[model samples]
Target chain A: MELEFVDIRVERDYFLIQGAGIFAPGIHLVSGRVGSGKTTLAMIAAGLKTPDSGRVKRHGIGSVMLSMQFPEQHLTGSTLESEIASWHLQPCPVLALAGLPGREKDDPFSLSRGELKRLHLACILSRRFDLLILDEPFSALDCREKMATADRIGSIRAGITLIFTHENQHLPRVDYLWEIRESALEFLGSVPDALVGWKNKPSVLADLHKRGVYPKNLSTADILEAACRTHD
Target chain B: MQDARLRLLTVIILSVASFMSVAGALAAFIWWIIFTPGIRTIAKSPFALFFLGFTASVSAVIWLTGGDGISYLVRMAVILLLAFYAYTDRAPGDFLDLSVWLFGKKIGFDIGLAAEMSLQGMEVLSDEARRTRVAFRLKAIKFGFRSIAPSAGLMIYSQFARAEEQADLLAVRGYRGGGMVCPQFTRVKGDVIASTSAILPLIFAIMPVGDIFILLQ
Candidate 1:
């Protein structure tokens, strides 16, 4: 599915986004400083929020799901099992998919932060949407679930994926990159093609990467391989 | 079709509510008459009297519906009122908050866990805010018509700074949500004594006044 916006403007008290468009199919890795309207742009694209001017046109079949930054806010059910079930028209196997088998009977509120994030992501991934919107999704997961999610996203790179992140998180087999600059989006080519820009990335991300002691690539596999090779 | 246990719990909960409603109405009506003998608040308080009267009437209806009649209704209303009087001095807010805390601790998540989980998302917001602020400080540009962004940026930055620190603090403890699977509640001596001595009278008082079992006594 492809989404085209001719010229869109979203105005917030502290920030504004003007003239944003996406003409890609795979993951569009979005990065920006705070208040760049990256999230607003994503939400507007997904039809969750409306733009002040310009048109947002969607040429796709299937659904668009916006997985939020928090898991508990998304929990409408008082119980864990019902919350997952309420996500779909039918029963959802998310409890098992999220590797939370027995916790189905347990309360959602009672799960750890990382566990809740995983459970929420499992719900998002369980259904196929034309566009999958995940905002800062890599927060609270262990290395394993993070890898698991990245792999799942990579395999199903079938739909349009808009991932908003501040971390130099390896894009899950992405096609394009958009940096939110001064409340507007700046195109940074494709993932590996955009490696040059990664070198010049701010110290915040680069420092973490240095501390992580991994390769300079923006994908988990490359980092993993580099680490394993170092060990060997 | 409620399970027997659920029905029993429901009966207890509703009966308490019913008793409280009547007592509240009585207090309001009396307060209006005594304090504001000619005040509008007193006059307006009579509505609660109507409401409580309606509730007591409903208890009567419930009594009759269960195949019990006037003697049952009067007795139940009397019992409920008596229970209300006996518990009159108890602060409602403290009692309810205590129950909420106790229930949260007992069956659902504990206060610490709920507070922790609720605060986790705030971390995500704060992180995003902090990054946005750092970038803002890096660029330090004054963009017009988008004052909102910077404001949100600053707010998020401050909130996250405080929140992430709190999250770090929480991690210092074993806060893995289910880390402290609560100790299973067993009826101890205090519980048994409380149930037998204190709660039995309250229970009978809450029972709609005219059940043959209660009336026979």
Candidate 2:
């Protein structure tokens, strides 16, 4: 499955976000600064917002889902059971996965932000969509939860997944790297090669680059492996 | 209107006049065209759909009851249009400035602060509602009568959460009550002209149609 943006342009009062790229079936990591149109690009890709010009062409993609930045925005159910059920999934398994197994009777809003984010992510990840766009999936998560979420994301084998985040740490193993710079989305090529051209890269990656060591992927484990290679 | 006081006064007069009579409604429409931004801006508001739905439903009811449905629809539409204009043209502290200028530092300050906060809350509510709609679309859940309860529940919960956060912020800022704020307003020639013309609608509403015709003659 592939999703293509054919010269998509979104005009705002101050700046315009214009880009063209094709997202193939794999984990694509999109990094950008805050208020740099990351959410806008995600929304456009999800078909929620129409671009001012150009078109988004989805090939062999039947279902699409966008997990917004704020988990509270996804709360449509009063109880945890109803919340999981809203996504058309079984409450027991989802609650178990979210680490709130017996809290089905509790209100979803009553959960802390991190807990809510976990529940939201669990619901979105429970279903396998052809196109899955996660916008800042790690924002309200703790370090452990972020790592767990990243691992869960990395385990998905099929379909296209686009992750829009400013998160420097706890990233899943990505196939491609893209970034929005000066109000434009630039494709920096695949994996380790892409890391060299990444301007807003994480400190670890920068350090590794300085030492002439490149990681196989963006995952924390890969970075650690690259760090150990420096000693070798 | 640049001046909040004059704008508030114009809104009140135009609303009353429009509700009072058909001639008054016509006058208000003319004033709206001349003074307020434009009909296009008001039509773009999220509340515009609600207003149209409400007016249509009420007008249908009136027609069924053998009342003057058309006239009622016209008058109500004009009144809602005036409200939309006022809401769109409003600055952040416009109502607060007007209230403080009208009342004293203690009572006026409290009232103005309340007004300002309420307006800000409305903006936040609008944004939340839009996001909720988008979320509903993403989940492929059709928004109908069954969904109203959940939507309302989310709105109420969010409002309470925001109110608590605002209270905490105010406490952190050492807010007691009745703070000092000098309300300033910039009046242009157009503001004065618009404010003056707004009175014509009230006069038309108060005077008989025959009397207005004679005066025109």
Note the chain A TM-score of all models in turn.
Answer: 0.82, 0.97
Which prediction has the highest DockQ against the true structure?
2
lDDT, candidate 2, A86-136, per-residue tens: 899999999999999899989877899999999999999999999999999
Write candidate 1's Cα lDDT for B1-217 as tens digits: 1122222233354345334434332332332233222233223332334544765787678776885444444444533443333232122233223333455544334453554444444445645544443333322324344633534543444455666776788788755543334322223343333223333334444454456366778
What would the per-residue lDDT of candidate 2 be over residues B1-217, giving only the tens digit for each residue? 7888988899999999999999999999999998777777576578777887899899989989999998999899898899888888988888888888999788999899988999888888888888889878888888887775877787888799989999899989988888888989989998999999999999999999899889999
i-RMS for every candidate (Å) is: 13.9, 1.1
> For model 1, what is the alpha-carbon lDDT of residue A198?
52
* Model 1 spans > 4 angstroms off: A89-92, A169-171, A198-217, A224-232, B1-217
In candidate 1, residue B78 scores what lDDT?
39
Colliding residue pairs in candidate 2: none
Estimated TM-score per prediction?
A: 0.48, 0.96
Comparing only chain A of model 2 with the true chain A, what is the TM-score? 0.97
- Tell me candidate 2's interface RMSD: 1.1
Instruction: Give model 2's TM-score versus the native structure.
Output: 0.96
Error in Å for residue A217 of model 1: 6.1
